[model samples]
Target chain A: MLKTSLSKLTIFILTGFLMVFFIGMSIVFGYTNTSIQLAYEAFTQFNESNEHLIIRTVRLPRALIAAACGASLAITGVLMQTLTKNPLASPGILGINAGAGFAVVLSITIFHISSLQAFAWISFLGAGLAAICVYVISSAGTGGLTPMKITLAGSAISAMFSSLTQGILVTNEAGFEQVLFWLAGSVQGRKLELLAAVSPYLFIGWTAALMIAPRMNVLAMGDDVAVGLGLKLGRIKIFTGIIVILLAGSSVAAAGPIGFIGIIIPHIAKKIIGLDHRWLIPYSALLGASLLLAADIAARYIIMPREVPVGVMTALIGTPFFIYIARKGLSQS
Target chain B: MSKYYSFRILADKISFLIDKKAMIKIGFLALLTLLIFIISAGLGGMPINPLHVLQVFFGGGEDMERLVVMQFRLPRIMVSIFAGMALAVAGGILQGMVRNPLASPDIIGITAGAGAAVVAFLFLFSDHNHSLTVSIKWMPAAAFIGAAIVGFSVYFLSWRNGVTPVRLVLVGIGIAALMQACTTLLMVTGPIYRAAEANIWITGSVSGSSWEKVQILAPWTIILLIIAFLSTRTINVQELGDEVAIGLGSSVERQRFFLLLISTCLVGGAVAFAGGIGFVGLMAPHMARRLVGSSFDALLPTSAFIGAVLVMLADLIGRTAFGPLEVPAGVFTAAIGAPYFIYLLVKTK
Candidate 1:
């Protein structure tokens, strides 16, 4: 019991360290590499100069967007994997990204909606619908919603939405250039207002997720065992699913379908802190935020003066981790 | 659905029988491929009769008709059919060796790996070298090498004690996603000027086929198909699961490695020519299995036929659906194949 407390303390300290590190990083790396003093000054003092303005407006907001979206996606990914009992399950695999992307395209093409708040709602609706479709389809036949079925159904659903998105984008040439970076997913130059708009959903979702993490431990003990342990399986499943969509939907709305973080962060957290959701969930959130902010920093510097998309950097980093987990865990299973 | 056509004598001692039914299925599939070829070839610009398409091939039509049939439609259709057959056969071998219906070249990251290499080739050479024609010449070889590397990585990555189909599949999906990300990175970072072109390539089209590509693709596809068909006996053994295959005294590891080699080659060659068309790999084997049962010998040819038919039909729909604005066959096939796959998923035990 004492050892457990020590481990928890270690995790909290590590997470705190990463949070500070990312905050420092968000201020330092950009067009003009600022002195740490200037970075601090930009935060405290109001300045209209281009460098301070960049630090103040661009870098700060971009960092928060990255952190918020990354944290939301990573948590959703954990819920997805746990709920499905599949190591591979993530927002991308479960059609949330594609669903939200399709909604964005639909809003642009049909509804002609340009606001972030509207996209957030549309994205959530699309995500919820896609999740429902995937669940219903996978749950239809015998041995309801097996990992294999969910995987297949998710693939199909993702394909369906992406195709629809491609169709709309191809025909509606006006939306193409506008959506280019959005589709690729970046935290650069985005308005803090967008992040502000979606923060409530994320906050509620995170709180709900944390509240249920202990119960998720019960649910993770397999269906028969969980039922035997006096857990209501249906309520847990429905609640778990709602939180996943809430988290995933907002992230996609804010960032336009960032990949790999959702899948990768939980694995990193698991490697560090083991599988208890109580610790795993928060550890994953902090780690995911740090990773995304770091990737965004690298994304800015990699091409120098020009930036690669944040999505690209995450994919590059997360894939090896993904491959590693697949090797170690999947092979054993 | 099947007719007997041949007898085979194995080892001159215990006769290993070759069912005639498999050959008949092959023959029917061949007929379907040829018929689809004729019909689809006659489709674009103005819809000509299949007879006229044949006549145009024989130099019996107007010059415009001949050009449309032979130069424009025929080569692209031939590429589509060849690519489809190669992918389907690759999928067949993977499904058989891996003992999972989910196993496909695309799922295993081969196509995406190949795609990433080609995109790199495009971005790198086109920018610094300004020698796209030279790089295009080596694109197929580069894609082949990239796919082989990815295939080996996935195979070895999944190998622990011995590989299980589930593990291999899981690893394949992870690697596939990563490789896809690399392709996206190239498109996003390299230059925005080429974004439109890069977009089309990512979607996996069979457009812009020349007679030269068709010529290279044809022999390569046929050779791979023959090799795949000859492995029918080994595929048959592997299908009964690993324990049974081991019980039957075959070196399951060696056989699986060789099958992976064949699938990598087929996918590498096809994707080199046809970009990144997906779902044909997953859908064809399932369709063939429905028609001809689980036997690889029969399933091979039937799948090849169905794959060729599916892609050709997708191409026709893609080219015609938007008229002046032709969608890639990959898009149409995805639209069709994803639904069928969902249906198959729901149907599976």
Candidate 2:
């Protein structure tokens, strides 16, 4: 583990560099296959050629959305793990993503609203409602939110929302075509303006996550220990909860309900750096951004001309890691 | 009045006590299930009267009525009811063996595994004309194999010394996500028509169920239900927690494996015919518990009847409620089951 702050900072900067490199890879490669020179020219010199337009409009926004959503989801994962004290807890597993996706689909099919801003607010409302429902349901019993209880509660809620979403899609075929890729969780075809709508919430979530990293360290050391140390447990939890909703909700709004990045990146960060949230949070963001950018790039190539959604790519990658963690037992966290 | 009725045979070599109140509740549920079956059968596109459904049953109806009732309605009704019964029984076994109220077949990935397999089967077997190259009759077999494969994998993967309930559940969740991902991947890559067809199946419908499906699923489900019913004692013992059950000289792991197998087979048979009918397993058992306490013998039968009723009603509403759209029964079940699930979570203490 990196004991010295200098070493942690060095590695953190290195990861940020790696993230930038992957972002570049994401931009340069796709179905159209632009070069670094072409990508550079697209930004520096505006000639509206087919490749340049694809580079400037299509590739860059997708890359940014993937990076931002990945980072947000990963930070959300760190906060969720700390808040629930469950290693397996993430927005997707806990139904926040499904809830947000469900809200978007519901509005699309029912109200026919396609506005990006509407998606942002609707997803936040959905994510917040699901989070509260899960918390309330799991906390209702005697033990007050055991990991098992919360996991079950979350999975149940996730199933409910997804099934309901399927119901709507089954009934409305046109809406089905419109929302299928989004529901499958992709960072493709999203415009910069789409990212622009939810970035402010994403910014607040990132800033708040970094700010609370120290208290999260205390909170991670068991509830009794944190209480003995005079942290206002309830307020901190609510604060973290809002941040989670903001981060997870906005990302789902932007790129559908991408799975597994949140759960996978936090653990990867914890493994590289120790459990210190201060370093872990930033490291996780970089790793998450890099991993998703890499996945998004790979997603383009996996199915030839047809792109498999990046969400499916991450799920394909993440399930094995998830099973390994599960097999290692819950106490390993 | 005594609450217990004891049945004995072969000089007390076999004896079991039945709860009178539970028996009464089961009887009532069975009647309710019959009512739903008849109502659903009678109220489809033709809308035969419920009284005329019984008349058709006794071979007294016209040819068109026979075609609609005998050829069309009965098979789908039977499929849904039997599938529902199988799912509820499987779910009851799971909740008991896992010692968790929230445990169900879908939550643990059985239904999803079957769904992925079915979708993959459709995608793989279809020719350039978008029709199956092989007989679609083999889809159930594919679904069964898929559910068994995933069920055993979850059990074996969670096996560290022995499979703890928490580990099994966690592993199952991971596997479930993977299966869902697979389903989505296949759907997206396939034609949009295929995606729509698969979506209807994934959301689960009994619309196209034929007598052939009923014939296969009925015997499979009935045999599993009987086996499940006979194993109620083992499930009851396991429900007391693993340590206690082991202390009582029960082969806890072996019994758990046995119970898990039964649940998987039941779920496989159900999913094979009905597709991924969500939440019937979860909802039925809990509703049964409310009706007839927590005893396995009472709970199992009660849950089966309630499940049959629930799915039959869901199918009923699906076909009848939405004007010509024909929503899948799984949708209605989720509509009711999700809220009830939240309530169960809240009341889980």
Candidate 3:
């Protein structure tokens, strides 16, 4: 047992080390003329030179957005799985991303609203509305919010919102570019101001999620047992719903609908640390951030001078791993 | 006088049998569908007068009116019907196979595969000037190949000693995520123009569909429909679970493989023609099951008809509701079908 625990600890440390190494690599690599050594110097000295501007202003912000977006999405996934007690539950599953995308599309096309701050607020509102809608729809019948029911309701809502967004785009030629970019789920051209704007909400969401980890543990045991243990099931559900909206909304606002990170990362973390949410949440956050940052780094260099959306890279890497975990989980269950 | 009394008695018996609860409900739904279809066909922009449409159908209209009705509107209508029917059949087969109402073509990675393949084509070939011949011949082939890859991957990955529905679904989701990721990568890195074109296609559209597309799709759709029909017996037996199916002398593995292959073909063919239209494959089977009973034999036909009707109505709305600037048929179907699907989900259990 001691040897096994020690080996697990070793793996954890290695993952942590890999995360830091990748972040450094992301800072060093770029599409421009600057060599790796020069890039390092520019990064460390806060150089105001042209090369420094390209590295610090352009590449760094993009990488940071990727990391932050990825980590938040993965954490949201962990919360969703725990709260809904369904392995398939993710932020995308609940239509939050679609709602946010629709709101952004409306702002751009119909309302002619262009400010990033306004877009963020609109996305948050849309996400909140979508979650409430899912909750109400799923809880309507007698068996009150079974995992399967919520999954179905979420898919239906997602379909509806995404269709509406697509309808608007197809009908109006002006909104096409905006919709296309948003739909691709990129982390390019983001500003630190945008990141700062979304940070408070992310912090509050993360804190709330951590605080509820113990309750989630009990909740996972089954609703009746959790209720018997004096947990208010309704309150917990509402709280988690809000947290999902905040996390998912802010992430979407910052960097479009980067998906699969939220769906795949938590499953990976769970395999490493078992079902305990305390470890799962933190581990998923770190791992998700690391994974996204690495993918973003690859995105920049893969097609030099052109970038792939970080979302796509994550999907490629995360999907195979996700498939493996799901298969394993199914067999054991 | 006694003979007249016997005739009245016979009439009463016939009425009583027709007015039984199940029959009345089915009749009502059928009537409602007809009403929707008629209204939809008449409501589109550049409206062909209902009378003119009828006259054209009967070979009595002016050439100009007949051309408009037959060449443009008729093909659009036919494509929508074919797409809807194919998707619904695929959904019914999948849901029955999985024993999960949520199982749809998209959920199983077929849609994602098609989407990814289209994006790859746009990226790799957008720069070439050989437009007409290349697009007509190669586009559908690309979609088919992509869909086959994803479907086969999901099936193989999910198969251990034997395939299970739950494992299949889970693996499909994983493969879908991967395919989506590849799609995004292509969109982001490829030329902006190509990405834009691919994006529009991915959301789905039946706007520019021609007779050629219809011809390409019809044979596969008919063949797959027959396959779905034949598999219904095995599907019903499998619903009793694998142990019982085996005991009853059914080759569960072979049956499942064939059914999945047929479903993949249906989805791939429809998507090749119409892009990744959402919701019909997911919602049609559930609605059909509710209308008829769960027997796959009955459910498949009902779902196909309902699916076709839904797509036709959606196409009509897509063309007419906004006027001139048409929404894709895909968007319309999702808007209409998703809410109803949600209602079903909430009400069923």
The model with the greatest TM-score is 2
DockQ class, candidate 3: medium
Instruction: Write one digit per residue (lDDT tens) for candidate 2, span B261-336.
Output: 9999999999999989999999999988987889897899999998898889899899988888799999999988
Query: Against the hidden reference, what TM-scores do the models get?
Result: 0.92, 0.98, 0.87
Worst 10 residues of 1 chain A by lDDT: A324-333
lDDT of each: 0.81, 0.92, 0.77
The digit string of per-residue lDDT tens for model 2 on A162-208 reads 99999889989989989999999999999999999999999999999
What is every candidate's C-alpha DockQ against the true complex, given to 2 decimals? 0.49, 0.80, 0.50
Best by lDDT: 2
What is the CAPRI rating of model 1's predicted complex? acceptable
What local lDDT does model 2 show for residue B132?
A: 93
**Best candidate, DockQ-wise?**
2
The residue-by-residue lDDT of candidate 3 on A286-329, one tens digit each, is 88888888778887777777777776766677677667766775
